[model samples]
Target: MIRAQLELRIPNMTAYETITAAKKSAIPDDAAMLRAAVELTKDISAARAAIYWPDCFLSAALGYGALAGAVLLRETWLAVVCALVAALALYRALLFIHELTHIHRNALPGFRFAWNVAVGIPMLTPSFMYENVHTLHHARTRYGTAEDPEYLPLALMKPWSLPVFVAVAALAPVALLIRSAVLVPLGAVIPPLRRVVWERFSALSINPGFRRRPPEGEFGRMVFWQELGASTWAITLIASTQFIGWRPLLIALAVFSLTAVLNQLRTLVAHLWENDGEAMTVTAQYLDSVNVPPPGWLAPLWAPVGLRYHALHHLLPSLPYHALGEAHRRLSAHLGAGSTYAGAHYGGMMPLLAKIARSTMGRR
Candidate 1:
C-alpha cells in the first residue's frame, strides 16, 4: 500500500552500542545493553502517556456523536450528513485502534481491554495479532523488499496486468476476507492450495514471516484468550443491538465501512504517491509520506484521528498521535527545510491519483 523509499545507513555495531550506552549512562561497557533497553522502554512509555487522554476523548466523542446523529437525524439528506459525520467518527475509532494497541499498559491504566473491545473487535481484527505485527513493524520498518512482511512485495504490483490491475487491487480486501474465513480453517489437509494461498498473502502488507502460530504454546494461549474474550464481547454487542433496532445498527455498520474506506484513501494520499524511482522500493516511513495542505477548519477534527500530521506519524509510529504535531515541529527544526517529516494536506483525489498512476506507469 505504500510507495515510499527508505534508506538506512547501518551503524557500525560496536561503535553504535558504545554510543547508545553513552546516551543512557557513563558506564564504559558491560551493563550497557540493559541500560539501552531500559532507555528505549522509557522513551516508548513517555510517548504513550503523552497522547492517552486525547485518544480516549476522540474515541468517546466518535461513538457518542455517531449515536446522537443517528437518533436525531431523519430525511435522506440528513442521513447523508449523518453518514459523513459517522464516517469521520468511525475513522477516528479505527485510528484509535492503531494508537491504543501501540500503548503500553503500564503507561496507561486500563488501556488493555479498552483497546481490545472498543477498537479491535469493532474493526473485526484481533488485537493480539495486531500487537505482534505492529510492534515488529517498529522493529524492522526500514527493512523493505519481500523479506519484511509489513511491506508489499515488489513483484506483487501488477498494474498493467489483465482484468485491470486497479480492479484487482481494489478487490483484494474481499479476497482476503474469503481466505481468512474459509480456507484458513481447513488447515494442513489442503497443503498444496494452502501454499498458493500463503504466497498470495505473503505478497500483501503483512509478511507471513512473523505470523503468529496460534496452536504453538503459552503465548499462543494468551493470544487465543485475548481474541476469544474480545470477540465474545463484540458478538454480544452486535446481537444485543438488535433491540436498538436494525436501523441504527445498519447505519453504524455502514458508517464504519465508509469511514474505513475514507481512512484507506487518506492512507493512500499520505503514503502511496511515488517519489524518486528508488523511493518506491522503500518502507512507508522513509517515502516522504506527508499530508498536503489540509483545510484550517479540518485540522482540529483530523488531529484527533491522527490525520493532520501523518508524515510525523510515519516517521515515528511509537509517538502518541496527540504528540505528532510537536514531534513534527521538533524533527522539522532539527532537519531544517525540505524535510519530508513535516507535511500539510493536498487537495482532491483525482490529481493525486493521476500523479500516482503516471508515476507507477513510468510516464512523465
Candidate 2:
C-alpha cells in the first residue's frame, strides 16, 4: 500500500525508462572517459585540496565582524550593506562543511574540529547532521529514491511549493537553536526523546519520511561531541543575549537567515528532480544533476564551494572542491560538445530555475 502511494506521487518517466534512455545517449564508454579524466587530473595534490583554513576562518570572522559593526552603526543603509556581505561570507564558510565531508581524512586533519568551532557552532548547522546523510545521496542505488535523505522532489511538487521550500529555510537558525539548546541536553537524559532526536533532528535531510539508525563507534562519538559543542554554544548565545543587548543577536539572525535562503536557492537548482522514486544508473544520476559553467560570473557567488559543478561532482565524488573546475575543463575538452556531459551543463541558474518551473507547471 505504501509503495503504491509513493508511486502515485512520482510523476515522470519511470526509473527503468529514464535509466535506459540515459544509457542509450551517454558516451559509448563513460567509465573509460571518466577514468581518462581522472588520470589527466591525478596530479592535483590532496594537500591543496584541503580547505584553505585561513580563508575559511577569515571569511567567517569578517562576516560576523561586519554584522557586529552593523549592529553598532544602527544606520539602515550601512546595516543592509553589511548584512549582505555577512550573508555571502557565511554562505561560503558554511559550504566548507560540505567540503569537510568529501575531504580525505589524512589530507586535512583537525580541519573538521576547527570548522565546527568557528562556523558550525555559530551557524547552528554542525557537521554531524550532514555526515551520514549526504553519503546516502551519493549511493548509486539510492540517489533519487525515498532512501536518499538529501533529495526531495521540489521541482515536481506543486508550483507554490517552491517558495514555501525556500521560505522554510529562513526559520532554520531559530529551529536549529531550539534543537541544539533545548533538545540536545534534554534528549540526553530521556531515552524516548533521545530516540526522537537521533532519528529526526540529528540529520540534515530533506525527506520527511526518512529515519536514521542510531550512531555507533567512532562516527557515533563524533556525533555526540559535535552535538554537545553546538548545544553549549547555543546555550551561551541565548544566555548572553540579556547582557549583550539583542541588537547583535538580531543582526546575526538576519545574516544566518539570509545565508539559509541563499543555500535553499542553490539547492533548488541542484537537480532536475524528475526521477520517479527508483534507483538510477550513474549516467541517469549525472543527467539529473546540473552544472552552471563559465561566464555565469555570479554562479560562484550563489553556488560557491564547488557546487557550481554539481553534475561533475556526481560523476567524481572524490574530486576535491578546488579541483572540480580543472576536472570540468579537462572533461569538456576530452568529451567534446556532443557527449552526455554537455547535456548536464545548464549555462546559468536562471535557465535552470525556469526549466524546473516549466517542469512543475506543465505537470499540472
Error of 2 at 39 (Å): 2.6
Where model 2 places Cα greater than 4 Å from the true spot, the runs are 1-29, 45-51
Candidate 1: give the clashing pairs: 149-207, 291-344, 292-344, 292-345, 292-346, 293-344, 293-345, 294-345
lDDT of 2: 0.79
Pairs in clash, predicted candidate 2: none
Predicted candidate 1 versus true structure: per-residue lDDT over 1-364, tens digit per residue: 0111111211122111112211111212222222332343334325454466556657657765765676568877876776777666655665665665565556677665666566555444445545555554444323333343454422224445212423344443344334444554443368765555444442224444544323357656755565455445545555666777657656655666555455545544444432222222112333334444334455545434566565445445566666655554444455434322222234445445554555445431
Compare the candidates by TM-score and give the number of the best one.
Answer: 2
What is the TM-score (0 to 1) of candidate 1?
Answer: 0.62
* Prediction 1 global C-alpha lDDT: 0.47
- For residues 301-347, what per-residue lDDT tens digits would candidate 2 score against the true structure? 99998899998888878778888898888888887765656767787
Highest lDDT scorer: 2
Off by over 4 Å in 1: 1-45, 48-51, 64-73, 153-219, 233-249, 273-285, 291-304, 339-352
